[model samples]
Target: MNARLRRIVTSAMALSLAVPLAACGEEQTDAGAGEKTIGLLLPENKAARYENFDYRIISRRIATLCLECELDYRNAKSAVDTQKMQFEGLVKKGVKVIILDPVDAQAAKSWVNSAAKKGVKVIAYDRLAEGDVAAYVSYDNESVGRLQGQGIATALGSQASTANVVMMNGSPTDPNAPSFKKGAHGVLDRKVQKIVSENDIPDWSPAEAKKKMTEVINALGPEGFDAVYSANDGMAGGIAEALKSAGIRNVPLGGQDAELPALQRIIRGTQSFTIYKEVRPEAETAAEIAFRLLEGKSIKSLTSTTADSASKSGIPAKLFSAEIVTRKNLKDTVVQDGVVRVDLLCTKDLATACKSLDLN
Candidate 1:
């Protein structure tokens, strides 16, 4: 989520709920008389998903139902202050509903509380927010982490212990990062020896990961490292580049986010696995939730249970499923379904590798 997006979503909720209680009166079906603006707040531009998928999905869904309704979107750029300021701006602009993906869950409490006081409905997106919220939408993050950890084990085969494993973690600022780390460690820390280096990447930046991996390569010498457990594909690509520059081959690495390059790396066997959180399904879920909220309908049918945030309990939540992606499962998971084109995954250098795996 981007910071600007958080404010936009929160503002939409705030502005919509701000409608005079007497006018709304529990449930008013009239679309023209009630809320008008819908805010979509994302945490940062660190991941391509925010710009490439979320904005379009949300805006298109809003347009389908409410032609006159406006969508106010923003990106926080990984700054709590910036996100908070954006929230205030959206509130001032009078957005009716807010779909928030917070940068700092702790720092977002004040905005959530204030929005609630003013009758705004805040729907926590991908990442959960603190305090009162209307609803939440995200994938099973822990499960995704567990899948990544399990994939690492399978990729290592019988020689996993001989391989030195390094961790390139996601941002500490994000709540999901810790969960992912915990889940991964639950698997890797048990059997793996020599935890070479563990780096908590800032803003999930590849450049930062490249710097850290380069340093690790320098410290450990050129070739002894066995694997890099990069939190996402962006950082995994960075780690791969560092390894290539050092001329250290025979490494098995893992990453999440089936980005184009990561998929290519998987095809070439430079990267072992990636967690594919498909964009269309995730976006469609968000779209459905927003429309449901707008119609004053209970989305209870859409959600199964609740996931509590650090400062909030029993927050309504809907979590989608995530799948493990490897070169082996590439055809079934992404390529066959056309989530990622096979031509993109199989480049000239990777052609031999792809064919060996029976990839057409």
Candidate 2:
């Protein structure tokens, strides 16, 4: 069983034994009691998700929830120090609540502590940081990994017994990466024949993933691995390109993030599948939590359950479910949600593929 399932079972058993603990009552400064500034610190801008979806949805929800509220947004560009500096600047500016998607989960602890000292609440977003935080909002990350692994296994089927698999994971700095890796391994290790190459992506950078894939290709040869377990769509793109450059074709590649390009690749049969975690709900939930904190309101009512990070226990969290997007449900999911337009998806080269697959 995955951590989520285990946790759910544990939570059920512990419910009767649960003792009422004092909630972290809002600590609104004099300035914060009125018009509030909420800091939105995102980890990077490279992934289209942050710029295209996360920021827009979260900002819009905050605007809808609180009219007088202002969002001070900053992208860290995948730099831990830069993120720390941006967070400190928000503190100096007296933002009441900060919703942070950390570049480095462990390193963000110091900033979380600093914000606490000033009576400011820090809500960990997307990726859980290692600290005593106000709240955390993200998808069930282990489920994402399981989906990716299952996709690859489904694609390969009986070949899974003989085929070598390459596991391409996300950045080591982000805490969620390990959960994803563990979850993928949970399924892959038992089903797959062998894992020939596995490596951690330095920054979850496509360029880095491409370079690493190229080296892996050279070392393992073109026909060595029959499947790839790409942690997310960005790295999947890199892996796909590397395979194409090496003249490898029809190799099953699994990814998360359900990026447009990866979805396009799935339709064209160049990639196998991608996991889609609807960002709208996650973003809105975090925004709502921040608004509540600023208004001196309790957030315990908003939480669905609790999660643990490396350094904290029983941290209040709201983790959403993830869906696997393949050729089977492309139209039903991302396309229907307007995450990708039909015209954009069926353009030029993909027109025939889209039509043949009844993607319209």
What 10-residue stretch in candidate 2 is worst by lDDT? 16-25
Judged by lDDT, which candidate is best?
A: 2
Q: Write the per-residue lDDT of candidate 2 for residues 1-360, one digit (tens) a residue.
A: 344554453343234223222112333345543247888889998888887667766777777787767777788998899899888877876776899999999999988987798888899999998776999999889888888888899999989888899999999998999989988998899889999999999898888899999999999998888899999999999988999999999999989888889889999898999998877779879989999998999999778899998788898899999988889888777776656778888878888889987867
Q: Model 2: how far is 116 from its true place, Å? A: 0.6
lDDT of 1 at 55: 70
Using TM-score, give the best candidate's number: 2
Clashing pairs in 2: none
The TM-score of predicted model 1 comes to 0.85
What's the lDDT for all of these models? 0.76, 0.84
Model 2, residue 117: what's the lDDT?
82
lDDT of 2: 0.84
In model 1, the number of clashes is: 27
Candidate 1 lDDT: 0.76
